[model samples]
Target chain A: MPIGIVSEPGREANEFKFITPDDEKLKTGEFVYYNVSLETEDEDSDLFSKTHKIFARVINRDECRGYPDSFLADPEVNPKHVAKKLGVISEDMELYRMTAKIIGYYDTRLNDFTNPRIVPKSGTKVELAPDDDLEKFLTNIEDVAEAFIGDLLHRNAGAVDIKLPVDNFTSTHLSILASTGSGKSYTCSVIAEELMKPDSRAAMLILDPHAEYHTLKEIEKMEEFKGNDGYKPKVSIWGPEDIRIRFAELSFREIISSLHNPSDAQEQRLREAWNRIQSSDDYGQYYSVNDLISECIPEDGSDAISDALTWRLRNAFDRELFDHSRNLSISELLEPGRVSILQLDTISAIDQQLIVNILFRKIYRERINCERNRDTQLDFPVFAILEEGHRFAPANGESRSLPILRTILSEGRKFGFGIGVISQRPSKIDDDILSQCKTQIIMQIQNPNDQDAIRRAVESVGEDLLSELPGLTPGQSVVAGDSVNTPFLCKIRERHTTHGAESLKTSKRWRESWTKNAQVPDKVVDADQDKGAEDREELL
Target chain B: MVSKKIGKVIGSNSHIDYTCEIYRKRDKDNPPTPADHSFGQFVYIEKEIDGKNIHLIGVIYDSQILDPDQGRTGPKLAEPHEQELFHPSYIEEKMTLAGIALLGYCEVDDDEFCSNEHCVPPWTIEIDDIVRTLSDKDFLKFHEVDGEINLGYYQNLMELAGPFGTDLLSKIIDQLKDMKPDEEKTLEVIQKNIEFSKRIKGV
Candidate 1:
């Protein structure tokens, strides 16, 4: 149904003004269209005529006509009721002048909008674009492997289902940027569920610092993720106690950075010891920390540097994470149809960084080897999600994992390795790494610094969408970049698995505590009261 | 029903305000009296446009008594009662003039008086057009259209009535309230507004 008529051209050529009596439906970001007939010429000068529905989005609204202010002067009286009493018909009382930006017509062959470079004349009827048409025009998800993320936000609930391209986002990196409690982790879980579905069985890993992703174990019980051809996705959660790292896997710099305030001479001595160990004829790719410590003794009898290096090495490597023979195996952590969640809640910040550093470096090299047809434990492509990404790759501070993360982001696509950097503080994340992620799912972020960081990092989200970041409620997101045809707001779908990251209900807990205290009995009888009395009498 | 023939149009100050001369006769029974053509009276003038009869609805706003002998110090040749017998033309010269502000018009078809009312009348009042008082039924019918009390020409009445606009409109609303009780709620709002406007103007 036609809702408005074009009034005139706007300040920009791609924009035009329209008049609508409806005050509610034509809100900002609403899609509308007007039909236009055009003639095209072929190579032989033969003409073909066709009609196209030119689409536009409502950007702004101003009240052009309404009930007089005096009618609303009395606080006790309703303006509409007053207008009705005054014989001023309600239908003609309110009018709005809306400014809409042209999105052009959808070209099916190109799978994108084509600018017609034409504005509708005054008095052209502009109708609301139906949800079915928008569903077809928004994304190319018909026969391709897709992840059902959510629905289009501005439309009615369940009107338009938003399914993102699985292969596009999985190959290219993805980023989930949101403030605290904005359902960023929940959205990640939804994506993980989609990846584990029967249609697309992907090998994915989640570096969960808060242990929130363990709920994804529910996928093993869900039939939706099970394939009819005897395929079932696996969920493996490795807690802090179960994770192990080898001292030989850490680079020289990584080992130095993991120590607490290592002196310059001690670092130099450690590097010399590392070089000596690597150059020895008896050395192997799998050497223990004891071998490096043995090589660190000085030949000149300088005991200070060597003793200090031993103390720091023993202090850093003497943990459950570093083992001589046992470590997280690549073949077990990454399978063709399994989701491995490495929980790091019990580990400290430095240990967390070291773990991510060692794990990502191993997986990245294995992916490269697999792509080259070399013998590798991880022969399939893998996507990894790093929670609290800023901790591993700080912007102002240094981390052992920043360089490896940057390498994986820039060169991982070619090697079938993708990384999703999920961070609440985008400003603290490394700019290079944040920009390298080709697709971004941004929820509400109120901090100006984080919003500015997103603006600098993500290029696909326009200023109009960025302005709406502060007002978006939880579970609402603005998805942009290569996974979608255009940047648009999305109402995230409910997760298949139970969400584990909900906030603590402080008020309900306080109320229950008061009730429990009030209900406690002040006086109580013991089972051996008479026996206790008799024993007291005997003692007296 | 045309209750009484009150006056005839003598002249017009504007397209909306007309002046009429009242017909007063002491010998005739139930003749047009001063009360019949007094202020705030709803009246209409009959006119034919394109062979269709219509009533130009208006209200008496002001009046003037024209006495030809007011300033004369010299005595007449006959007494006041004898002057009508000796000089009947002289007695007929003295008249009562009523100022009528046109509100709107209502179409008339045969005995069915008010078929429809329109705020914009295509024709103006002509000189010597007979003015008659509207029956109570016709007066109530004139203010109602589409099953509601419509005063679409309330602004015209206010503009043409000059200083007594609010008072005249309030009187019409008060009279219609009693005639149409079902629409009293809506009419009271208009009445209160006019009363407030009068106080605001310090009238």
Candidate 2:
């Protein structure tokens, strides 16, 4: 057979080629269909369902002889059977081929058979379809394993990588800011949990004014899961009786203020008597610092400590040398192996400030001294987290402990002393101390003043990022600063232990009480009250 | 670096060299006379420079000035001029000789006070003032030839010139042409020579 090529529809064929015996069986000028099956990865095979179609064409057997082997292989047949087999031919797949000259392609919603459509070859190098199936398959399986381990690990581990920030916090100060319900507390809990890990030798002391951290005791009760080597969180309570001090520690003014009333000359005599008593060997046995004050001093206008000293003097004059007072010294409070929580719940806000200031000053000074004494010069780092910091670290005036705190911020890195001042009202905290923090975890903050305070404190934060603060949902926070390599907007993991802290639900309580009394009739309550009234009248 | 002692009064050339092993103390106490007080209270002087009218303060103890071969020190005075000197700004107390050459002076009366409450006496010369005094040709020459007119250079030149003639400005231009700009080395020198004032100067 000979196949010829024609330039025009009615032009005579000039170029011709001989067809082999295999091609002779095909009818000349007949319409035939060519079918191609596209193969892909098994997982992605479903993507080709809509695109599988056979192309039909009329073959000029004499002219096809001049054609290539690929052209001769296709049958010169009508697409009549191809339509029935492919199921997409009657649905304008043929019309698409005639107009666009495309063979096989995946159909899209936007494709219109009435107009010429652009289609891709089944096995073409260029792919029009999205290639997400392979990536999706891999992600789906990996997500399952991630979820499984997620449950096994504590919530702190699943939260943002806090270790990097914690390590940075050792050298730099950090701040955590967030809005209400933005998991600020949970983030704090996570930090506390991480710090308490056995391998972490760092000591942490948190002043939880709202009693939100009571749930930590519950988290500690969980059985050690895999990878967690029997680490437990311990909490100790400290009262006023833990501190120890001597009369010499008192200032001259404090000693004078502790004396009882008499003439000016008598007051001098009282001071002399107090000095003589202090110098005796049995001073500790005959009188604690408090005993000397009560015997000699009048209780007119005196400081709280002076008043306490006077009261102690009048009460126990014969106490033994080993006698322990109710109030403990600073050393007792910071003793190792004890996570001391000085519960100020029963104390007044003013007293809490005074007490916290005393403790902070003592702790910072001790840590500095300890660092200097070490031969190898290793510091026992302690983190002091103060909740509701605005009350103690107020902005209006310098705190009594401000000097010690400033020293810690400026020089505590080498001494291993870290301080975390937590406050909802950032505007009320001292600006100097707030600016020193190198790490900050910010939650949703709706108050403009607080936001402005935070903005001023963290000079590097942009206004656009601060604008997003108020809308942040619960359990979410923006963690930024030297602690994190890059600022991250992260959803804080839920605390493993349920928080005892919660807003009061007034409506729910009312509804539950109403339901409980629904069984009793209103008339029954009226009759009982009337009966009780009658009985009382008769008795009277 | 030999510290060029400064005087409390303008046009006075008595310098207390800080680099000297022992501090020189005058046995006779000559308290400052009311006449000795001038609007430009602080003046710069070389270590050995002496004057009858000026009261001595301290010297410019800049390390860069000691090593003249390194070129960190600015242009030296072709000839030392005996005249009153004043710092442009109260913020700076000391500067290198090269630094002093770039900034020009603004003349003020001996009793004239500075408008700024914080600045020491002898009000600073503003860019506008400099432009007003120098001719277009001289101004163009300064702009093209003088070292970068940064805060340090301006303050240093003003201090060296004090209230004297405009010779320091020309010297700065010659120095800029003589040396090539080495940004890294220049910055290092500037960092090493920074000094703080002992007391707040009158404005």
Candidate 3:
């Protein structure tokens, strides 16, 4: 029962010096508890005294090991197994003391945990929190509208799988940052999966550039998590073929802004051409890019300006960037609690920007309308998620979508317009937007500049966590913000849906192909490929 | 035949108090492992004060073994081999010691024999007093005789209040299934303990 003894009285009432038995697991960040009766003065009282135990978090550990690592490394030195029988310099016969900060104590009278009012006397025996106590602390829910992200990890131990209130987490805006292979997208996928739960009614719109999340439509079918039967995420995938936006719906300034850095004079001339087409009876109603170009070609606003406008318009026309029907509405796609992924991979960069610009603008406007008027059809808040956010909200270069995104990040939450910016390079994300994101889901980031950027942006993340960021395993993240009771080091929970953004194992694929080709006849491989092509066609 | 004296009460603190510490030395002959002063093992601090042989009874609720020189003191630990040359090996070798936490004592009649009634002892022990094992044989000595007892004895031992009390209750429960003292005597002892707590609670 006496696992350890309080060695030092901490500067605070709750902090204590705990001398622990030298188990390899006895290290910093371990949780330990010391028994302390609330009424210390009632020494003679028996059953009436309210005895409570205070829980403390070990911040640092110090040990006097039996032998040097060098001595242990030396092959010539026989391990002192005899020491165990003698109870001398054995491996387990070492002393370790941990500096633990008292977290809080359970109030038996109030039936809830409260901050420590009295410190346990020095030499207090410390023990591991019983399973029940640990479970109660970790599983206590702060709010009902919580977003289930992952299991909270306590010093390599799983405390509990708890939820983070999305109302606090998302409405304040959030950023998921990590290196390319550090499970950044997987973390986002977990969030997406949670959002798309059948019972959830929060809308999430993912601006996916590589069509990474389109497979979410069949994610529940993934063999690993097929047990999650009730988890059906209402996913709507929008690709260029499935979506159409009228060119006439875009303003003259929006049209000119999509050009490759059009000069001020060129912008002015294009604006005049667009004005002339709208003013005329034949094309005044709703003009397409072709009509705008034809009007520009006959304009008297200089031939050079008309030629530039025509070339830009012709390029957009060739790409089939627009349709007469304005059918893609964020209100329709990002319905409450539904997950919609726009596969912008098929669209050109210029057209991608124009489309993202329009989508974000519409979402922002809808949220504003919803906030102002309760009668708005889509009354719920929506989180606009941008994958590879660096492309859209780059710190260095300006993009057509940046202005509206900046506006959303700054004031969107006020109107139930939340933003989730997923980025690998936190340093490359616009500081204004990054700073506005109150909750930061930081995964393993090895870059010092990115770490520095995160440090400057997130005041809640301490030096200890910042130091630990680079060493975190994939799918492990530190959640720091007002959303959680405290900053949590957590292992992301298994996604109910298949992780659609996982990188292909190039080596494994190559090995399978080469080995199969060598073993099988060319005719057989050809037939297999033909069949695979047919299967793929059917899947499409 | 005198049994081996495993430890002695440290005179600096009051042995009469419900809780006390016993220090034991391990030499060449006694290479005492943690097993020597295991938890839940009951013992007695025996002394001849004014030729009145006394026994201060308690249970070993906890034990701490230390070779201070080898065991780091401060929260600051040095590098893996930090104290290799700085600390004297002689200190570690000679200072190997154990301290057992003893809480709960019982009352004995004038004839130096325990009775059905137990109480917190009034006498303390000197450093010279010997700490000897209080085995099941010693527990059986408190057979049928009645004596003045502490009113809170039931709360201290039967209700399972302190470390020793809980351990004693557990020990009794373990023995109960095997009918160590038979059902009648066990029932009588339990009834007496509850009656004592009820009387104290009424007061």
Candidate 4:
């Protein structure tokens, strides 16, 4: 039979079998089967004829082909009686065409075919080819969003080694820039999740200025599949320990300097007093700055040391001295074997900056000490993820913590500690810190300042890639750094939980409020009558 | 009998003692006399009993000064004072006569017997000195003739002769004389003799 020709009305055309047939004359790679199907005219018609438009090659003419019985038993014609009537004979009656090219054959098995193109009698054709457009193939934004979140639970083992291909984020610094509602929270969460993986060996400490990351608690409890089991992600939260300065554990100098003084002379006196106290054996043992000041300043004459000491003692003893107790200290939060989050929800931006600086300094000091004391060459490495980093490490040298944080950005790598900064205003973050980041997982960032900042930070990022950044769909990020083979946009694997980034649904809320309060005059009168009748019934 | 032979080989009659004095002027104008001297110097002399030319020097301080007239020839006139007054000069002269006397008995020429210069005793010897000279090999041969010598005894005596002694050469000759011509034994003896000689010469 000629290939691609439909069968005539009453001709005995060739029967195509996927396996060995009654006619042993068919050769390998030769067209053997005539594609035919039954067409129904009206709602009920028993008379059916074969309509052929496709052909199959004799890929395996030596073996019997087994066809699924359901395919042979037409469901529409005889749904209830089909299975009983068809039985094993269904395999011989059904027809199949060779839909692929037979490349080679194996003696033990059958020949292998590739690029299968299935042309059903009336349905859409299905094409099977090697994946050439991997990016496009996986480019479905919704699917990628789901995978980006879903993969957080069913973590592929290969995912742990997939670092964002950048260098020196911790040592150099970085920023996350996007519009307020443009999945900045979700992108930060994804970065946090990637860093928190066991192999990443990173510690995520979110400053959480707006308390937005409190949702992470719920996300961490989302279902994660392991083999056949499920688990909840684990993270630890830390806040200020107590109201006292001793409990807060500020270094003596930090406490003295943070105090407010009336004049330059008072400040100088306070400095000398602080120096004396620090040089003394009993420094930093006091319960509050007031106690420390009271002990340092003596009741005396108008010498600069005596006058300054008295003023400092009086001023620092006030309630304002304990103002720092509201913010948390990093030393209290840094416990080994746990991912610590220092939520700075209660503090202002300036105070948060101070707290983050203290935390970074403490962590850097501890890591350096640990490395120095290690007996062997290999030591455990730690990563510190700084969320909302712009407040602490700001552009234009405004942030009080910038200098120290810049030091960390420039030197943290050699100490085996890394830093990750997440911000929505990349332009506002320190350039020194941002430029040091070797890996960048850029999400949708539309702001020109943020784009320019990112462009300046990553010198190697091309203009083409930079232009593509603002248009990136939710959950899709462009990963570029030493970790990635190339700068390619990746569909972030889905998170395991449904707790996506919470966004303000303004229109829906407004419409729901309007509908809730909408009423007519007649409805109000009926409602008043119903209430009166109910009251009368209750009296009876 | 070996003792007598050894005594003759060592030249018992040719034994001599020579003494020399070194003087220091305490003060140039009024030098202290020997009687008033607080310190004195002497040599503890050793003579090689065998023909080996070994000499040892030892310095002595505060040694007793014996009567110089007892050993000197033309200086003993009368009293002990007279002898004491010229004792330093007298001892110097006696030391020179002793050197002459020893030179006359041996083949060592006068030029080789100076006190101030380093010299070696002559290898060639007069008949009188030959009778007196007991070479270590001759001493070992005397022991062998008296039937007192065993392989171990001869080995010990040869060891004392060290590598510079003629005993090693004599042992090589004796090894070559065995009628059975034990080439292996002869070579072993020669090698051991060479090793001994090298050790003594420190080469």
- Chain B TM-score of every predicted model: 0.87, 0.19, 0.55, 0.22
Per-residue lDDT of model 1, residues A1-540, tens digit only: 899999999889889999999977877767899999878665688999889999887878899998765555556556665455444666657999999888888887678888798999999999999999888887777677899999988888889999998887887899999999998999999999999998988999999999999999999998888899999999999999889987776778668867767998888889999998888878677788878888888766749888888888887787778987777887889987899999999998877887887788888878888889998888888999999999988997587678789888999999999888899999999999999989899999999999999999999887778888998999999898887777778999999999999898999999999999987755665655533665765645
Cα TM-score of candidate 4: 0.43
Expressed as tens digits, the lDDT of each residue in B1-203 for candidate 1 is: 45898888999898878899988776256679677997899899888898888888888999988988778788679887788899877777788899998878888886566565546577888888989998888888887776666676777788878788888888888888788897666566667767876886565
- Model 4, residue B33: C-alpha shift (Å): 99
lDDT of 4 by residue, A1-540 (tens): 232222111111222223222332333323322333544244375656644223333332233344433333333433222222212233344233332222111111211111123333322231221122222222222211111222111123333223332233433444455556656666666655654433343444665666565555544544331112233345676543331233235554444434443466555565666567666776444445554555456666356555566565454434431443453444444433335655656655655665555556656766787778944222455566666778777898776577667877778788866777777788998888888776666778888999999988877555645777777777655555533233444555544434444777999999988887785334546654765566765645
User: Per-prediction fnat values?
Assistant: 0.03, 0.00, 0.00, 0.00
**Model 3 docking tier (incorrect/acceptable/medium/high):** incorrect
Q: Which ten residues in a row have the lowest lDDT in candidate 2 chain B?
A: B124-133
iRMSD for each candidate structure, in the order shown: 3.8, 40.2, 23.9, 57.3
Give DockQ per model, in order.
0.21, 0.00, 0.01, 0.00
Q: Output per-candidate TM-scores for chain A, rounded to 2 decimals.
A: 0.88, 0.54, 0.77, 0.56
Which scores greater on DockQ, model 1 or model 3? 1
lDDT: worst 10-residue window of model 1 chain A: A78-87
Q: Per-residue CA lDDT of candidate 4, range B107-197, in tens?
A: 1223132222112222222222211222333333322312222222233223333432344434433533342242334233434444545
lDDT of each: 0.85, 0.43, 0.65, 0.44
Better of 1 and 3 by lDDT: 1
Candidate 4: which docking quality band? incorrect
**For residues B130-162, could you state the per-residue lDDT of candidate 3 as single tens digits?**
666665555444322222111233344433334
DockQ of 1: 0.21
TM-score of 1: 0.82
